[model samples]
Target: MKKLFFVGILAALFVGTTNVSAMTEADLRKKFDETVTINGNKYAVSDGDKKLADDYLAKYEVSSDDCDYIAKKIDEAKAILTAEGQEDLTKLSESTKTKLKKLVSDVSANTSVKGTVTSGSVVILNSDGSTFAEVTSLVKQTGTERSNIAIIAGVAFVITLVGACLVVKQVKNSNN
Candidate 1:
């Protein structure tokens, strides 16, 4: 009975310690969409210098540049999200827009403009002293209870082995 209990406990431990990758691509896609929409709106109205519409359009290229940078991040995240078999954008949260803006602002200030519109991928080169970083995904870690299961199972297995050793010794003595 004790042996069976220990085996059951060990089996449960292995089952409980499995690592599940929680950051699905679908979540990234939704975040990308939200970022594009929010940033696009901001870019359209950001006129650096007030003048004629054409003059504003010509001088207003800076906002477009910012928009393009945010767009590239969104596109990259979308591709990864799609390849991971996540097609739904509805799972993205409202807070994702705020998070993406902060990420873009941080990345943009440190990186230099790289590649033309003709390049397949928009590459942002890191400045001479700057490090390039991107916000990928936010995921929750495994719970403490799950981690404890492995320790409990390990102790149970050791106890079971000792019990089996004692039972074998008792049998040998009885037969002698």
Candidate 2:
């Protein structure tokens, strides 16, 4: 009877742990979407302001490892523009800048679109309470950062179950 009871407890523990861990991945994805949307919106808005642009140009020092490569590209472009002279390139420069700004806005819109699609999927899943493989694939594309949360949660849950099992076993042995 005690062995049966132990088995039941362990089974329940395992199932419960897995379910909790699975939910955490969804939660992390939701949080990541929220963060990206907020930050991207702010960046887009700040980039539109002339004062902010001047401030950014004056104070911005590129610190990332990738910054040097980006800076080199910028320098090369500037050298080409300077060689061509501002008078000849003014219209071209304005058009290029406009296109770049539009591209940034489009990218920001894409992020919003992704978030909306994920939210819609969540709503549909909740209404039906069904776990479709397609939904899982969508979440997976959001990146491993979301998936890693689930892994961490699963590990925590297993550790907790093992601790509980040890306690239960000790209790049962003492009673025996």
Candidate 3:
């Protein structure tokens, strides 16, 4: 019974320590929202600018349907912006236009949206079909954890070496 309990505890510890990549749609949405909020706060925008950005960003709700919804939306936006002439949409700063165009280009490359967009407002694409936000976040966390483990291991090795040296010195002194 005691051996079974020990095995159970070891199993539980292994299970608890395993990395999990479980992410829900709501979690992805929150990450998107937090990113937008951070960017929004990072720069100063007028009410009108904020409203425009909000409206533009709101159009993208991540869908798992695997349809070409992103391409369609980009085309629609482009058509609307360039309908008459480029002059009319001059109010959209060159930087914003460049960013949006880059975003559209990125989204266009991915035929399927396996996971949600990250960092870039609404339509950023991760080439591998895995989520950029979640994957990067996990990678960073794992890197930190690995670094911590390495540091702990180094400290333990040093302590053990020092203790062994002390023991050896004590034996030599006793023999003398």
Candidate 4:
């Protein structure tokens, strides 16, 4: 009888302590949007140029790594244009095309894209594992700052869990 009563009380206490407002898909999406926005302004290629590159690859034989390299080069070209006070890239001038051609040829002779360039779309997944993978990828792309944030978040979660357990134990002790 005592064991059953104790179990019942424990279940009740746990149920009462359950958080009603936990993280939702919307929250994750919001964060994704923010991250993508910030990264895009910082290092991403223009959407129009990205589309053109994608279309070009659709009709060409290209390795994944080569495609990534090409995309990176395209973004670099866009960065140069932005730096030169040329925001619009409606038409590629002969000089610009010549420069980009040289870049492409140079890149083709070397390695493919490897590091996280912080110049991609935001991806959110339905499953927890997939979401975690996306978060890991994002952290990698964002570099050390986000990695530190992830570590701190993990520590805070552990602390919160431990604090909750202690509170439950204290409540049970008080009841006794």
Candidate 3 deviant stretches above 4 angstroms: 1-21, 37-91, 111-176
Cα lDDT tens digits for candidate 4, 1-176: 00111111111111111112343535423322221112123323333323332332233333545545644654565454444443233333556545644553445354331111111222212223232111112123545988899999999999999999999999999999
lDDT of each: 0.33, 0.31, 0.36, 0.36
Ranking by TM-score: 1, 4, 3, 2
Model with the higher TM-score, candidate 2 or 4: 4
Lowest lDDT 10-mer window, candidate 2? 1-10
> Model 2 lDDT vs. the true structure?
0.31
Q: Which stretches of candidate 4 lie over 4 Å from their true place?
A: 1-59, 87-98, 107-176
Candidate 2: which stretches are off by over 4 Å? 1-141
Q: lDDT by residue for model 1 over 55-108, one digit each (tens)?
A: 322222233344455445545433433333322332334354334333434434
- Per-residue lDDT value at 160 in model 1: 100
TM-score of each: 0.28, 0.22, 0.22, 0.25
Query: Candidate 1 or 4, higher TM-score?
Result: 1
Better of 1 and 3 by TM-score: 1
